[model samples]
Target: MKRNIKRIIFVVAAVAVWVGAFFMTQRLLEPKYMDDLIEGALTAEYYDETTKHDVIFIGDCEVYENFSPVTLWENYGITSYIRGNAQQLIWQSYYLLEDTLRYEKPEFVVFNVLSMKYGEPQSEEYNRLTLDGMELSPVKIKAVEASMTEDEELITYIFPILRYHSRWNQLKSEDFEYFFKKDKISHNGFIMRADVRPATTFPEPEPLADYTLPATCWEYLDKMAALCKENDIELILIKAPSLYPVWYDQWDEQIVEYAQKNGLAYINLLDKCDEIGIDFYSPETADTYDRGLHLNLSGAEKLSNYFGGWLCSNYQITDHRNDPDISAVYSEKSADYYAMKEDQLRELSEFGELKSY
Candidate 1:
């Protein structure tokens, strides 16, 4: 009996050490989005949210960079979160919504329609930025299967170390600093930029040979709509007021027709830019940092304020600002939001750009 016990203990100890070393290696090799490429960190940050969100926005950078949840909370008492990624494909957005539902179902789901233009996976780098941060689940598996490019491998996502193990020599300070955990880099999913660079000129949009959004894109959208309906959640589609990658008339017509067919509300904010008080062309009042591609902190707040009013008027979203528990959560979030904004401004004033983000 003693001999048998000793053998079993030795095997267990060996397995434990091997398992620990494998995970440690995985952690050390994986790219830490802490210093730069921070957008990769956004998806994982949602899991750390303490209070439940009433509205969830999912799409590409347009949804994340153009809208501010903290502004919505302060102005209209609406609590929200954005589950956005860089160049998020429609299927990925749908899967992300599904993944979000696994955690908490919100009263409303807002999707940006810019991704409708993409029918297939764009790039493996973007796929990793969006998927690697997601917690392992059936939804993530499906997202990976749908998002992987021709050259990409599925096992690489499951075991990122397989893809990044060679990064041993390139590993930086952050690789170890954030080895155990990551810092919250966004303000309720909003990446703040206080610097301003006004829109000057944009390259003429070369007309696409085909105006019709792909069948695959529409199919995933149908799935998104059906899932929202089954969960009794309202879905709102919007074309954010981005000046480039022009929103063609033919494309807008198709979305309008679809919205009518499904009894959904699709607001083209590009049409309401003037009404929303956005001065994209003026340097003194410009809201975008990279010309008109994405909004700065000032622009996002303006957009959120207008959109929040429209939402409250059209829907019965409960304002949790007065709710003691939720209020406490927002209070802490608001403090962080302003502090970051101040820091970004200080950085911009002194250094001509932000360094901490």
Candidate 2:
């Protein structure tokens, strides 16, 4: 009986060694798997690295909807990238920031204030999504090095188990691909051109209730603030525009108070949607696509143009769209797009229906 037990142990050890060898060897052999899983996974063509002082936008779909790196590159001359995710939480934001600061550090981080307005999830989503979609880069180690408690930050950042205690399933070979590819650019933003839906306004996703944020969400938000301060990176907290009914119902004076207390730079475009110029009540709209949550090509163009102006006016960025090569691409792509977007802007300029939150 003892001999049998010893035999079982030896067999288990040997199998573990063999499995490790296969993964390690395969990783070295087919590093493309790493590239495939992680590469160009988000924005068009994925993971395109930019130069110094380039803007880095981080958040959920809002970031995607609000800014176009390609447009930023073409319009502002300051290259940028979107590190947005779908349904990402505040905890995930911290990790994403912690992980993102690894590679090329940006001049500033535009953190979407929406998560601060988020209702905390009861499940492990906050931590799980952070760990799962988490990509560790050159910034991860530096983040730890700069962390107040280096040891703990290093442990949690390295393993994620310390931070996301519920992350039990170890990363298999498959995850390695995702980790590496998260850096890629996503091409499919606001790609759809035509819109076909009458726009009224959306009801509150819930009732007309004030949002009471969870403490953990606040903890992550504070960590992000501190992390930015520690790294000497500027944090621009934006309160982006959405429809009025939902916007008023979701965010209130309490949210306003929190932003003020944090010394966050708030850009509340809620009522300024008209000043920014968007035909929200237009007969044709993006509501047909993704119901109404995301923006279409027409919207994205307006956003890029608006944000492009904002970046130029406020941020220390230059407009280089005149550069022959970029403009050639933009000019080529902007043909019909320019027409559609201009019409939207013109219509919005004419139709004044923006209600303040």
Candidate 3:
């Protein structure tokens, strides 16, 4: 009996130690986006949201940097969140929509058509930015499988330590500080940048032998639409007004035809720049932070205001600003939003550019 009791205690202690060691190693090896590479932190922040959004925006930087959910709520009483990252792919977007449905179903799911340009996984660095923060689940597993490049391994995503363990020698103070918890990096998934860089000339897009979006891209779009349909949600597709990367007429026609065939609403904001008050040609009305690739805070507010008004007028989305509970939550969010803006402006003034953004 004494030997058996000792043996049981030994096993229990061994298991506890192993579990603790595994978690600690995981924490140490994980990327802490508190410092640089903050886009990496955006994906995981959605889980921390306490209030359910009426609208959810899912895509790459085009959606996140171009639309401000804070502006949407403040201007139209529409609560929204953007699940976006750098160079997010179409398959990743579809799986993200699938994962989002596991939370609360929103009235509208807005996806940027820019991701449709790529048919296959682009890079491992981009894949990590979008997928590393997602929780361990079948949805995440599928996203990993769909987003991983040829050189990437599934085990690295499952056990991130395998991917980042080498960074032990280069771990910064942020790695230790944010190991257990991280500061909120976005206002409703909008990474606010206050600086302005006017659009300049770019090399003309090289003509593609094929203007047709990849069949695989269309497959994911169908999946996203079907998933939204299953939940009785309307999916709205839009092309954000990024001046570079030159959105072609051929691509626009394909998206327009798809939307018409499926009875979905598709808006090409690039065509509505004048109506939306976004001026890429004028330095006085500059809206982008990195030339014309992404919108800054000023442009995002303008786009969100226009889009919100359109949404309220067209869709069944309601003005929740009067709801005391929801209003209270947004009131706090508004405070944080302005605070971040002020900080960014201050940083720009001091350095002639935004350092943190």
Candidate 4:
């Protein structure tokens, strides 16, 4: 009996030590988006939302960089969140929508159509930005299965340490600082950039033999629409005003047809740029950070103001800025948002460029 008791105690102690070590190693290995790779942190930050939003936007950098949820709240009393990442694919957007339905059901879901151009997974790095932040669930599992490129392994996602263990040499102060806790990198999923660079000359888009969207892209679009319908949620489709990546007319036709068939509202903001008061040709008016690919803070605010008015006139979304609880939370967010803008401006003034993102 004494020997058996000692053996049992030994096993228990061994298991406890192993568990602790496993978690510690995992923490150290995981990427901390505190300093760089901030886009990787945007998707996961939605889980920290204390108040529910009336609108949820999902897509790639187009939505996150172009839209400001905080602006929506302040200007139109509309509450919103953007579930966006770098190069988010169509299937990933669908799974994210599914994952979001697991939480509070928003009145409207805005999906950018740029992702529909991609049929298969694009890159492992982009997949990490959009998927790594998602909490484990059936939705996340499906997203991983759908988004993994040929070079990716599902087991690496489940045990990220397996994928990142080799990053030991690359570990920095941020890894230790945000090992257990991560700082908020977005204001309601909106990643703000307060710098400006005018639209510049770029290589013209190569003509494609086939402008048709992939069948797989259509499949996920149908699934997303059906999911929204089943949940009694309205899904609005829009083409964000990106000057490049060339919004082909053929692609626009398909989206228009899909919207008509499904009875969904589709807005091609590219065509409405003039009406939205966006002057893409003039950097002095509508500024962009990386040439014309993504909007800067000024452009985002302009777009958001226009979108807010359109949303109010079209939908029955409630303005939560008046509710004491919601107002209190957003007031704090507003302070942070302005403080960040000031900080970025100061950096730009001092360095002639943004040193930190």
Q: For every candidate structure, what is the RMSD over all alpha carbons to the true structure, in angstroms? A: 0.9, 10.4, 1.1, 1.3
Best by lDDT: 1
TM-score of each: 0.99, 0.61, 0.98, 0.97
What is the TM-score (0 to 1) of candidate 2?
Answer: 0.61
Candidate 4 lDDT by residue in tens digits, 138-202 = 88999999999898999888889999999999999999999889999998888899887778787
lDDT of 3 by residue, 211-326 (tens): 99999999999999999999999999999999888899999999999999999999999999999998765675588888899888999999999999989989888889999999
lDDT of 2: 0.54
What would the per-residue lDDT of candidate 2 be over residues 128-203, giving only the tens digit for each residue? 3224333556543543333222224455555543454443354456455543343322432223223434355666
Global lDDT scores for all candidate models: 0.92, 0.54, 0.91, 0.90
How do all the candidates rank in terms of TM-score, highest first?
1, 3, 4, 2
lDDT-best of 2 and 4: 4
- Scored against the true structure, residue 207 in model 4 reaches a CA lDDT of 91
Worst lDDT 10-window in candidate 2: 31-40
